[model samples]
Target: MLVRLAVIAAALLASTGTAFAADAKRLGRYGEWESLTYTEGNAKVCYIATTAAKVTGGEKGKNSTFLIVTHRPGSKSNDEVSINATYTFKKDSSVELQVGALKHSLFTKGERAWAADPKTDKAIIATLQRGKEAILHASPAKGSDVAATFPLSGFSDALASADKACNIKR
Candidate 1:
């Protein structure tokens, strides 16, 4: 099941016509975090994925909820965060990521939310590096709002694994 889900997640990030293998290499596992690496054409793709530890106030969808921090060296996209709400988000609404004393916003699209730009990505990654936990809040289009919490115990290690997998520094 994880293999299948990894393929789907990779496909979601692939450019048009790009192909990804169904199985992704397990770079390492750190508590709730899992570092995975795969290939899309000639580019190396790496990401850390984790299931939400808690979810509140929304009906569930068929797909499981997850959070990912991806690195795509070919596109210079590193430490890019994306969350799957598992439910549609209200139009024009945003998801909030609270990490330690910092609160960052992610723009929504369908059931997925992402950092607005490279600056926001960098900031969020920086916070995740030192924060103990992160909470993702989502407002569904037609249902109740949901808040999902992710532990950060192994985030730094997972992130380092991703960087190594993608041959990225810092």
Candidate 2:
């Protein structure tokens, strides 16, 4: 009986360790991500969070959207989400962003370019960053840079704000 109990304890410990390792790997690769869509003048800017799954593109290696996992601080429930923002690099090295059904192009050479939702005509600008994680910031763009640098913390806030402003429940 003693030997059997010891074996069972070892098995349990191994399983627990595996579970923790899996969780850590997931968090490290993809921090929580959110999607947002906002407008500037007549252009609409869409923001999406990139995920490990999409980034890796499976074993076949296909281009895919980013993925986000969200959990409230005190809530027991968690959610997995994704964002769709089409990007096109311009001849001038600027980028165009299309979120959901809205579209906007940006030029960061001079000051900042104005974007607006075609439907609402609300003006906004987006800042895109790519490093360990990809981040896009959507704001009024009036006094903001079309392409600005931001830290990881700022990226999280900008993502959340885009979700709120774009009326994206997911």
Candidate 3:
């Protein structure tokens, strides 16, 4: 369907690690999350995207912040996690993500952060499904330390939409 293709395209764009506006269709919305897909480079990509419920500290820039779980069929990086931190990270500093009682250390580059490996990505998703919320502690290059909170409500449903949209299992 046209709408489905749009969702795929949007997801692809979201996970691309670059800044760009998407002109795509949304597949669905699950609580605080959204299911999106879109076309890029002739390939379909699906992802679940959400914004933080609250953010504190860190000097302002564009202040564009969000999280994404993306699937690119037949690619090595499928089911990856990406975060837009809204500010460039300190050189060689990692972000700390706390969900419930678990904590994960994420690698950072510029204004983005992500799980260090595919296995970690899967683990983060699993935690997202069962945890209350996610709070990320980060240090920006030019500002004070920051903490961003993202609610876990509807994460499972959002992931299901992404999986179905991209023909991914689990």
Candidate 4:
């Protein structure tokens, strides 16, 4: 299931222009996370991602859900956080990520959610780095709210692989 999700996510990011990569190469898999890199025009794109460890929701079409952090050194974008909920989000609704006491709200569009700004993205990444797990609470367009827990094991190594691959400085 995870392998399928990783493939789907890579394809989706490429097609949606979020990853900005025409072809992605797998760097390695660390625990539940995978690091990938690709070239987009002249820039290099790198990201680490993981699928949900546990998904508890009544929402249908809850497949291929995952969380990602991308780095685009050419664009000076780093630690850009995004989530694929696998279901169209409720219009104008927000998704909340909880790691310990840290909580962040991400703006939703279609099946994806992203931090409103780079600062928020940084904070969320920091929280993920320090927490053992992250729980995402989201509202679907056609069903009850859904909550997914993503484990943070090996997240640091995965992010490091992406950072090195993209030449992103800490």
Candidate 2: residue 18 lDDT (0-100):
31
TM-scores, one per candidate: 0.85, 0.21, 0.86, 0.89
Q: List runs of model 4 lying over 4 Å from the truth.
A: 1-22
Compared with the true structure, all predictions reach lDDT values of: 0.78, 0.30, 0.77, 0.83
RMSD of each: 3.2, 18.3, 4.3, 2.4
lDDT of 1: 0.78
lDDT of 1 by residue, 2-70 (tens): 654564455444422334435477888886788888887777889887777777777755234577888
Model 2, TM vs. native: 0.21
Give the per-residue lDDT digits (tens) of candidate 4, residues 39-80.
877888888888887887737655446889989888888999
**Compared with the true structure, what per-residue lDDT tens digits does model 2 show for residues 80-158?**
2222222221224343444333344544322222232222222222222223333333232132322221223334454
- Highest lDDT: give the candidate number: 4
* TM-score, predicted candidate 4 vs. hidden true structure: 0.89
Q: How much lDDT does candidate 2 score?
A: 0.30
Task: Determine the C-alpha RMSD for candidate 1 after optimal superposition of all C-alphas.
Answer: 3.2
Weakest ten-residue segment in model 4 by summed lDDT: 13-22
- In terms of TM-score, how similar is model 1 to the real structure? 0.85
Model 2 weakest 10-residue run by lDDT: 21-30
Number of the candidate with higher TM-score, 2 or 3: 3
Ranking by lDDT: 4, 1, 3, 2
